[model samples]
Target chain A: MVTEFTPWQSLGGGVLIGLAAVLLMALHGRILGATGILGGLMRFNDPADWRLRAALLAGMASGPLVLLGLTGQVPAVDIPISNLAIVLGGVIVGVGVSYGGGCTSGHGICGNARFSRRSMVATASFMVTAFATVYVTRHLIGG
Target chain B: MRLLTAFAIGLVFGVGIAISGMMNPAKVLNFFDLAGTWDPSLAFVMGGGLLVAIPGYRMVLGGPYPTFEPRFQLPDTRVIDRRLVLGSGVFGIGWGISGFCPGGALPALGTGKPEVFLFVTALIGGLLLARGIQSRGLRTKAST
Candidate 1:
C-alpha cells in the first residue's frame, strides 16, 4: 500500500502525545501505556484505579468527536488486513503486551524517554520484528 | 481532578494519533516496509515525542512527588528478563501483521469499526491469557 508521508502532521501529533504523557506523569504519576491501562481495567484492583482507566478510555473513545470539531469530520481508518488476520494479530499483541509489560506508548514513548534500558531493548526488539514481518508479508508472501 | 486530567490527556493522545494517521493500519504497515512504499513519518512521531518527553520527564521527575499522586508509579524492575524481549518480539510480529499497536488501536475505536472492536476483543483475550499464565506460573513457584 502506497501510504503518503505525513511528516508535519505526524510531528504535530507526536508533540501532542508527548504532552499527554508528561501530563499523565505530572498529575497521576503514572505511565501511560495503552495496553497496561486496558488490562488494569479488566483486573479492577481498586475502584480508584478502575475509574482512572475508565475515564482515560472514555476520553479516547470520544477523541473522534474532538477530531470532528477540529477537522470538520471524524477521520477515516483503513484496515487493509482480513478479519482473521486482525483477530490473530490482536490476540498476539494482547499476549505480547501482557508479557512485555507495554506496547508502543509505554515502551516506545514513555519508557524510552526516561532512558530505561529495558524499554529501549523492548522497543528495539519489537521494531526489528515489525520490520521483518512487514518485509515478509508485503514483499515476500505478497499478503 | 485526577480523573479529569487523565481524560484530557487521553483526548490529546487520541487526537495526536488521529492527526498523525497512526490509527490507520495500512499507513503503519507501510512504515515498517522499508523496501516498499515506506513512510518515514513514524520516525518523526517517535522523534518528536522524545524531543518533548525527555525534557518533560527530567523536569517532572526531578520533583519529589507529582501534583496529585503520592509518588510516581514508575516501573521498578531493572532486570531485562526474557519475558520482555520474547513478548515484545511476539507483539511486534502481531503489530507488523496487522499494523495496529495498542496505542493506535485504542484511539481508532472512536471510528466505530467492527474490525477495530474485533481486534481489541482478541487483544483483550490475549492479555487475559497471558495474565493467567503468569499467575499460574507464580502459583507453581509458590507451591514449589
Candidate 2:
C-alpha cells in the first residue's frame, strides 16, 4: 500500500527544518547547505571549521539512528539491485552536487529563498533529471 | 555562540529528516518510482520545507544587513538561458535515476549505506563538470 503523509505531519517536519535552518543562521550566520559543508571539510583544515562540519554531518546521520533506536520503525527501502548499483548511484550524486554548485538543500532551500535565478534553474534541473532518471532506469531500461 | 547554535540546528534538522522519513533512501527512491509503487511523502517534505522557509525568509529580509555575512548569498544570475537549462537537465536526470538528491542523500549517509557513498561520488563529478565549463568561459549568462 502507498504510504500517505498528512498535512500536519508534513508541516511539523517543515517547521522543524525551518527552525533548524533559521536557528543555524541566526546563531552561526551560516546556511545549512550540505555540499558547502562537506566541500568545506574537504578543502579546509582549520580546527575550528571541523567541529561545525562534523556536527552537522553527525546530526544528519544520527537522526535516522535515533529513530531506529527509539521507535523501531525503519523506513522502507526497496532498491531491487545489487550493492554495486547502489554504490554507483551514490558516486554519481556526489559528483552532481559538486557540478551543480550546491545540493538540493543549498539551492532548493537557501538559493530559492534569496531569489537566486541560478538556484531556480538548478533546482528545476535537479527535479527534471531525477524524474527522467527514474523513468529510464526503472521502466525503460529496467535497471 | 555561533558554533553551538549551528550544531544545535544541525541536530534538529537531522531529527526532522529522520522523523519525516526523508532520511530513508528507500522512501526517496519510492517517490521517484512513479510506475512501481509511487510514494507521495516527498511532496509533504517539500511542503514542509516551504512552510519553514517562507517565514524564515521574512525574518532575514526584515533584519539589518547581516553582520556575520548573509546566510544566503544569492547567485549572480538573471536570465533563463542555455547554461541554466543544460545544467538543470543534467541534474534532473541524475536525481530521477538515483533517488538520492542532496538533502535526502546527506541524511542517508548517516545510515552508512554503501549506496550513499556512490551517489555522492557522482554528485561531485557533476559539480566538477560544471566548474570546468565555467572556467573555460562557456559561462551561463544568468547572474544576479
Candidate 3:
C-alpha cells in the first residue's frame, strides 16, 4: 500500500534525530551512528564504553515501547521482504557499514551535515546504488 | 547519570524513527523505487535530521570538551579511498533489497519483527567476519 505524505511528522522526526545527534556529541565526544554504537558495544571496550553503549542500545530497544504507550500503534510494516533477503541484506550491511565506517545515519545524515567530503561522496554513491537496486528489483526482477 | 541520558536519547531516537516511518520497509523501499512509485519522505527525514545536527555540531565544537567525556572522539580520517566507495556500494544494494539500514533496523526489532532479528544476527556475523579478515591481514602485514 502506498503511504501518504507526512511532511510534518517526518520533519519533526528528523529534528529529533538532529537533537539526538547533538545531545550525544555534547554529552560525550562521539558521533551518533547506530551501526558504530552497536559495533563498539559488541567489540571489546572499557567498562565505561560498555555501560554507555549498552544503555544506548537498551534505550533504543525501549523506544518503540514508549511510542506504543503514547500512541498505541506504530506505522505498520507491510513489505514483502523474504527471510533470505533479510539475511543477505543484514550481512551486506554489516560488512559494508563496518568497512565503510558508517551507514545512512553516519554518512548520509551526520557526516554530510558536517560538510565532510568523504561523507558527501559516500552518500551520493549509496543513494544512486539504492535507487538502481530498487528499480532493478521492483521493475525488472518483478519482486 | 550518563547512562540515564543515553537511555533517554535512545528512546527519543526510537520514537523519531517510528514517527518518521523509517521502520516501515515498504516506505523505505519506495524511496529507492525511482522507476516505479517513488517516495521522498525519507528525504524530508534526512533534511530534518541535518537541520539541527549541522548547527548542533557547531555549538558542540566550540566547547572545550564534551560534557561527560574527557575529549571528543570524532573520526579524523579524510581519505576517500577504495574502502569507503566499495563498502558503500555494497551497503546501498543491501539497503535497497531489504529496506533497512543499521540505524533503521536496530530499533525495528522492538516492534516484534522476527525477520529483523534474523537480519541483526547476520549483520553481527558479517561484522565479526570482517574483523576476522582485517586481523589476519594485520597479522600478515606485521610478520612481513
Candidate 4:
C-alpha cells in the first residue's frame, strides 16, 4: 500500500548531509547535530555561537526555496498522524533528545561515523525503541 | 565568514533532506512500519551519509584544529550511562509516532505549516523543561 522507496534520492540526500557534516567539522570543528544547534541557540550565552546557530537555522528554513528552484515546485509534505500525536511526539522528542545528549544527526550520523561507543549504544537504544513503538502503534493498537 | 559557511552547509543539509524524501513524515514513518509498508529509504540515507562521513571525519580530525575554528569542540563523555539509553528510547517513541526527528523537522519549518510550528514549539518547550529538570537534579545532588 505504501511503496515509496527512492533509493537514489535518499542516497543523494544523505551524501549531501554527510558533506554538510564533514564541512562543518572541517571548517569549524563542530558537530552538525540539528537539535544541538537549536538547543544551543535557545540557551545561547555567547554572541559568536548564537550568530552561527542562527545562520544555520536560517539556512535550513530556506529549504523550500531551494527545492522550488531545483524542481520548479515544492513537494507536498504528508503528516499521517493527528495533530495531538504531533504535539505529544514533539514534546517527548524534545525531552528525549535533551536527556540523550543527541538525536539522529548527532548520535546516529556523527557519533556512529566516529565509532564512538556511547553513540553506538545510544543509536541502538533509540532504533530498537522506535521499531517497538511502531509495532505497537501500527500492529497492536492500530494507531 | 564562519557564519556564512555554517549557513551554506545547513542549506546543503536541508537540500539533501528534501531530495532524500526524509522531509516527508509519512515516508519516514513507513520506515518503522515493518509489518506494514516498510520503506527502507531511511537506511539508504544513513548509509549514504556514513559513506562520506566516516572518511571525512578521519581527514578532518587528523588535523590539529579546524581551518576556521581554533579548536575542535567535541563531546568528551564516553560513558554510556542510563540517561543516554532511556532518553534515546523515549525519543524513539516520539519519532515513531510523528516520523519527525529533529534534523528532519527543522528543515520542514520552511513549509510554513502550522503543524510544523506546533511540533517545533512543543519540542522547544520539552527541551527547556528537560533542561530545567536536569539542572535541578544536579543541584539536588550537589546539596546532598
Candidate 5:
C-alpha cells in the first residue's frame, strides 16, 4: 500500500479530459463516451456515423503512444492479478458499458457535468462497488 | 471539419487519461482502495473534468445545435432502473478486479501487450453478448 500523491498531473489531465468532452460535444454534437463511440464502430450500427467514429477512435488510440513516446515516460501499472482475472474483469466492464450505457468518464465525468440523475446513480453504484471490491481484495484479504 | 474535430477531441481525451495516471491500473486501483492505500487523484480528475464540462455543457446547450451536426447526439436515457444499477455494479466488480475501464484500456492499446489483448477480447465478447440480448428483446417487442 505505497501511496504516491500526484495531484497536479491528475488535475491537469482531468481538465484536459473535460476540455476534450467539451470540444467534442460542441463541435460534433456527441458525448465523448468512449464505449458508445467505440461500440458503435464495433457493431457498425450506422454506416453514416462510421467515419467520425473511426477518426475519433484512431486519434484516441494513438494519443498515449505519441505522448509516452515523446516523453519516454512509461508509467507503472502494478496490478497484482492473474491474466485470467484481467480477462474476466474486461468482460464485466464490457458488458457493463454496453448495458449501463457509459463508463466512468461517460457517467462519472460527462454525465455528472450535465446534471443527469441516471449518471449520478450509475457513478455512485460503480464507485461504491469498486471501493468495496478493492477493500475486500486488498485490505481484508491482503492482496 | 467534423472528422478532424472528432480526431482532435479523441487525442486530447487519450492524452488526458494518460497524463492523469488513470491509464495505470495500479493508480486506478489505488483510487478504489478505500480501506487501504487510497489515492485521491481520482477525485481531482473528476473535479477538474467536471469544472470544465459543466460550463462547457451550458455553452453547448445554448448554441444553435452542434457545429457540424443538426442535433446533439446525447444520451436520452432517463431511467435509473435495475438494469443500469446491476450493470454498473457488475462493471464495478470488474473494474475493481483489474482497474481498466473502457476509457483506460482503449488508450493502452499502443502497449500491444498480450494481457491487454486478452482483456479486450473478453470485453468485446461481453459487449456482443449484451447487444445480442438487447436486439433479441427489441425483435421480440417488434414481433408482438
Candidate 6:
C-alpha cells in the first residue's frame, strides 16, 4: 500500500519554505528567487550584491544539513540516471532558467507569491512540460 | 505590516512543505518513479498549494491597491507564446531526467550528496546559456 502524506507534515514544509522566502525578502528587500540568486552571482560585479548572493546560496546549501543534524535522517532520494546525465540535466535547467527569467523557486514560489502574470504562465508551462516529459521519457522512451 | 505579514505567510508555507513530505527529496523522487513504484505526493503538494493560494488570492484581490510596490506581481502576457512553450519544454525534460527541479534541488544540496553538486553545476550552465542568448537578442534588436 502507498503511504499517505500527513497534512500536518506537509503544512510544516510549506511553512519553512514560505518563511525562508519571506526572511530573505524582509532582510534584503529581495525575493528568494533561486535563479535570480544564482544569476546575480554570475552577472553582477558589485561587491554588495555578490556578498548577499553568496550568503543566500550558502543558506540554501546549509538548510538540509541543519535539518539532517536535527532530524538525524537525511531525506531519501533515488535517481536512476548516471552522474553525467545528472550534470547534463542541470545544464539544461540552467539554460531554461535563463530563458524563462527565473528558476522554479523564483518563478514558482516568489513570482507566484507576488501574483505576477508572467510567473503564473511560466509556472504552468514548467509544470506542464515536466509532466509531459515524465510521461514521454518513462513511457515512450523507457528511460 | 507588509514585512510581518510576509513572514507569517512564509512560515505557513514552510510548514506545509515540511509536513507534506515534499521537503523530503526521497518522497519527491518516488513520485517520479513510474515503472517500479509511483508516489503521488507531488499531486498532493500541488493540490495543497492551490488550496491555500486560492483563498489567499481572493483575500489579496479584495484589498485596496497598495501605495508602495504590491506584495504580488502578476505576469503581463496573455498568450502562450513560443518562449513559454520552449522554456517549459526544456525545463520538463530536465526535471524528468534528473528528478530535481529547482525547489527540490536547493534543499537536496543540504544532504552533501555529490550528485547535488553535479546537478547544480549544470543548472548554472543552463542559466548562463539563457543569459547569453538574451543579451545577444538584445544586442541584435539594438542594432536593428
User: Candidate 4, B42: how far from true, in Å?
Assistant: 1.0
| C-alpha positional error of residue A11 in candidate 4 after TM-score superposition, expressed in Å | 0.4
Q: Provide the overall lDDT of each model, using Cα atoms, as 2-decimal numbers.
A: 0.90, 0.65, 0.84, 0.89, 0.84, 0.62
- CAPRI grade, predicted model 2: acceptable
| Candidate 6 lDDT, B1-103, residue by residue in tens | 4434433433333334434565454565456555535676666555445454444444444555332354444345556567866776677667766777766
Worst lDDT run of 10 residues, candidate 5 chain B, spans B108-117
Error in Å for residue B100 of model 5: 0.4
Instruction: Please write out the lDDT profile of model 3 over residues B1-144, one tens digit for every residue.
Output: 999999888877877887887878888888787766777888899999999999999889888999898998878999999999988888898888888888887778788878878888988888887888889999999999
Best by lDDT: 1
Tens-digit lDDT track for model 1 on B25-100? 9889989988988888888888878888999999999988989989999999988999999999999999998889
TM-score of each: 0.97, 0.80, 0.96, 0.97, 0.94, 0.76
Q: Which of the two candidates, 1 or 2, achieves a greater DockQ against the reference?
A: 1
- Candidate 3 per-residue lDDT, tens place, A1-143, comes to 46676788889988988888888989877888888888888877488888888888888777678888888875456666788988888888888887888888888777987889989988887888888888888888875
DockQ of each: 0.85, 0.47, 0.78, 0.82, 0.76, 0.34
* lDDT (Cα, 0-100) at B8 in candidate 4: 93
Q: Residue-wise lDDT of candidate 4 within A67-117, one digit each (tens)? A: 988889774568888999999999999999999999999998999999999
Worst lDDT 10-window in candidate 1 chain B: B17-26
Off by over 4 Å in 5: A1-3, A141-143, B138-144
Better of 3 and 6 by DockQ: 3
Task: Give each candidate's fraction of reference contacts reproduced.
Answer: 0.81, 0.53, 0.75, 0.81, 0.79, 0.39
Off by over 4 Å in 1: none
Pairs that collide in candidate 4 are none
Candidate 3 residue runs with Cα over 4 Å from true position: none
What's the lDDT for candidate 1? Answer: 0.90
